[model samples]
Target: MSAEIILKANHISKNFGLTHALKDISIQIERGEIIGLIGENGSGKSTFSSIISGVYPATSGTLELKGQPYKPSDTMDAQRCGISMVAQEMGTLPGIGVADNIFLGREEKFTKYGIVNRKEMYQEAAKAMEVVGVAGINPADPISRYSLEERKLIEVVRALYSEPEIFIVDETTTALSQKGRDIIYKILRRLQEQDKSVLFISHDLEELMTVCSKLIILRDGVFIEELEQKDFEEERIKELMVGRKLTGDYYRSDYDGNFGEEVVLKAENVHIKQVLEGVSLELHKGEILGIGGLTDCGMHELGRVLFGIEKPVYGEAVLGNGEVIHSPKQAIKNKIGYVSKNRDQEALILSASIMDNMVLPSLSKISSAGLIFKGAEKKFTARQVDGLSIKCREITQDVKDLSGGNKQKVVFGKWLANESEIFILDCPTRGIDIGVKAFMYQLMYQLKKENKSIIMISEELPELIGMSDRIMILRKGRVQKIFERSPKLSESVIIKEMV
Candidate 1:
């Protein structure tokens, strides 16, 4: 039986001045089939999608939709062609409710005499939620009250409401819970029934395997292989994405951790009201401590509080080695580094140049005798950039212009340049490509080799299990379980404690 082709991208390539983002990428997505786009960070999945959806026009290529030549000059044009992309980043107004966000531009359709038909919109939203199998969220409640995952769901519902013939979802599921992801799978199943196509992107290859029909692997901004389900293997996929056979699992020391004399971190009976309890934990030198649990578990709060971005009403974190970092500024001054899960929010200063961002943490460190030393600063950042292999045309490029993976590398550079001994990383590889993730893992390992301690907070059980030397599962602002080392680590083990 011949499959119906919904979209074809032929010889698609995009370049940002000297940096070639996409290279003659060609792909055929069949009608009603889910195509998985896989690549390492800066490998060009998003760029390809951007070119197809008119976020940016292709440098040179042809995009055919339903056997008709299609060139989306803008996002609105893409929408008109029944091709819509739900960006991983939420652009929702914090004051607006889910219903309004879902139907923002099309609110005029539900209006009567130029007045909003709120009740009708709510009813329609309820039906849409029902279709998408989401619950517990009030359409009337302000979007600000929602969790990161809930906001992501709202974004999904918003994009899906347009009934796009071809839907592009980029790295969205990491924010959603198991139940929420199931809802998305159900929605995609429904879309499949309607003969709609989807370009599904995620770092979770295992999850993609369950949902996508074929996996198109990209490397160095080029399409390398289109792997059929029959040929799908985790090791093979990882190898293809990284362009090398991985050595082991790319985690820290697999053996039981050998505790050092110095204390790296200490939090004493910290309280954050309803969100976080009187939590206390101590970290040692050269250790990678893992944190995980359900979405409501106080792990995120704990990270924030320890970092001093969120103040605690009670308790204090005493650094084991006497580094006074009670406030965020103090924390930065004391050489503590942080990479947030919400990449766009806490980590990136999008409007700033890459070099500026890379030195943001170490600005004071780079200056000497009350003078800005450009040469020394450049030398410091250049070394880290080379070590991290930052994928940018130049350090002067805006951090916003870099891909998710490269942007993250810049965040790492900012911290690494500070020569921080203690690092806090939250979902560091969330939206990046496998290659970039591999590099991040290697970087983490390298940091450990440098005898630096790290605290890794994540929702993905695999990364936590595959990486951390110590595992701590937080449940309802309390430590449910803390495994001393990799001697006892598994997704099932962590999941058992996390919930």
Candidate 2:
């Protein structure tokens, strides 16, 4: 990384109406450097990056790019100023082709006399897709035709097409599979080779440590600490980010793999066309069944098939009582909970209030004569808010206002409030900080102790080995191997089957 300063934030602060999103924060970015930003939800990490990328005008701050005063009117202006951001949330436009989505703002190249040239657009889009290592996707197909992971990869390509001087990657890996992640990492390294800079924001500490040359910690909208490449350590960075020392094993250290013989949930020959092929599994009472795989291995689709969110052309997902679940309502009625990998799009209602979202799954319990009681609902919501320690202004606070980690907490709170007996958590700790991730692991452990079953599908191998009673490795939509958890189980052993 070069010693030259590329971007500088001077006393930056942001506010949304009455809420202070960012405090007086100052930081510097060096050319040819990958900077990692770490903090808990609502901690101003995203707020700072957003301000720098011109997503919103900062409440107060001064910015300098390449040793000059830089103030972008908007995201487009920022892009023109050689700064680009890949947002935490999905930003692709629906109903458009992949090519159109990648080149959304740069359409002038394909326009002639105010008319768009479709053939050229498709060709350019395909080239970008290939450059990003995305295969088997038709550029002419609608963006909606692809999965969430594919869409995220497309966005990465979009950001790179312009070759911006500085790139902001905001919690994007949560939406990606391993293949997509590898491609992104390669792209970042290549950017560094070109002496460009990257501001990488993620909850995955290991990833940050591996890729970042510098680390910045933020808390409750305040700057905490900045560490050099030599100072990158998982536990230390985690402690600094949370503003307290973590006191226990991050994952359950116990090796008691014994679980109930009676199965709580079972998937039999489940199939989702090309996505999942005859995938099957059994979740016993009190067992954490960890599912591991690479992208295109069907682990994600398997979660949907088992939860009744995606209808399977073959086989069944059965409850203990021989009742087959065919719909989300049926799964919920049977005490089954599903937290999708794409938390923002598939799991939570971003624009709704905390109270409304918390009470959504169990509306029947809080309603009388199809009329809801606000007092009773607020009480129920408050319990979850306290239980999960969700940082929010009020129960009436919009979920969109909360940070990424807190938004995930709201999703967990919803399921916990419903008293779900069987939980299907896909990338449950994807975008959360270490403190919140540890809490989530504790919750899973407590649930296991209570004899509730869990199916944890994650790209994170450590989480799988740390918490699962048994691990199932998948490849190309088929079960490759299932290993009983032991002290000897390691990521290397499980990864052999995954690839």
Candidate 3:
């Protein structure tokens, strides 16, 4: 027998001022089905999911849930109507305990008369965490104490607690490690067994192929095609998403590991209060130095220290000119840029416009006689936006309105406009689509050719192997091994050092 339709969206369209995010799109979800939504940046993937999850109201559309007219006023309304979502951006609030974040809108359940039952809430939160296979997280502790991956898991637990019939996951797995991904996969399988439905959105084609029984493709705010599991093809999907055949190598073709002798940035015996222990490395001129390890490893911290965002308790990061980096001002003055892993929190200001963010780092350069030129600022911002192919109706559009991948592009554009000599990019392509990833890799290669240095910190081993002149593996706050790039370099060899 055919499966029952749980949700149906007909003639759905969304508009943001002059920008039309979704254009006459229609789709349906089936019970016990896990559908993968694939698209490039700004392809209406998130906008569609947001409409269903009650983040936004469609300018024109009709939604029916179990053959009943469904119109949710807000996220809570959607949840109450048997729909829940784990968004792409960080969803948990800071300065609150994990239990509070898990049961944010439903605290009345633990409220007795006029008082909230903290103990009961904590117990239930603990059980929820356990259900998602997340351990060592105290429900009473502040959510800020946890890492990005841990916070994402907490959001997952929150979504699951709603017991929704239809769940939407929007580009969430890109921030997760293999272990965290396994936990998510297990949850999806369990949901399938229970005859629930899921809308899985991700840029990782291989991952989508593995978890989804069918795929839906979108391009330029239009529905392009849909493919069944039997017809899945990576190249075909890429072509459909971008509306063109992807040409050239995704990463650098040559395996030559040679770099200039001059050390652009050097760290000596750096220590980060239990996160890194006597760790040291050198980033050479025109070299792509890749740092790889588990999510809890100290690579991300090391990047911060190198960029002078965090001061090491023991040692220091020095420049080629023998200048000891002490603060972000000093680092930026010496032409260093940092792209943080937590993009939403540390990298880009969501409330600010794209032009405001792109010109922030280059203000001094564009200023004359202690006065800023609006024309120059606009020109500078325009160059980066056009060069990066950032999808936006206008540069005045807020960064938060753009898709996740486009938001990341704004972060990169600011640094590129500043003309930094050394870049410390931590997970630069975290939530970006494949088309943007290719452009970024090419841009890095171009930068290397221009004699600029880059230190790329990523969790994906394939990316490290593909682009780095050298790969450094860290394990439990220490440098385990540093391998020079070569044709024979493999993830298996690197995994041995990471664990």
Write down the RMSD of all candidates, one decimal each. Answer: 2.4, 2.0, 1.6
TM-score of 2: 0.95
The weakest ten consecutive residues by lDDT in model 1 span 250-259
Name the Cα RMSD for model 2: 2.0
Clashing pairs in 2: none
Candidate 2 per-residue lDDT over residues 189-301, each given as its tens digit: 98999999999999888788898989999998999999998988777887787888888888998998989999989999988788778888889999999998986788888
What's the residue-level lDDT of 221 in candidate 3?
Answer: 86
What local lDDT does model 2 show for residue 354? 96
Q: What stretches of model 1 exceed 4 Å from their correct place?
A: 94-97, 111-119, 321-325, 373-376, 486-488
Q: lDDT tens digits, residues 207-294, model 3? A: 9999998899999889999899999999999999999999999999998887899998999999988799999899999999999999
Q: How far off is residue 347 in model 3, in Å? A: 0.7
> Where's the lowest-lDDT run of ten residues in candidate 3?
397-406
Q: Candidate 1 or 2, higher TM-score?
A: 2
Candidate 1 structure quality by residue, lDDT tens digits, 166-189:
999887787776877888888888
Q: Model 2: runs farther than 4 Å from truth?
A: 130-135
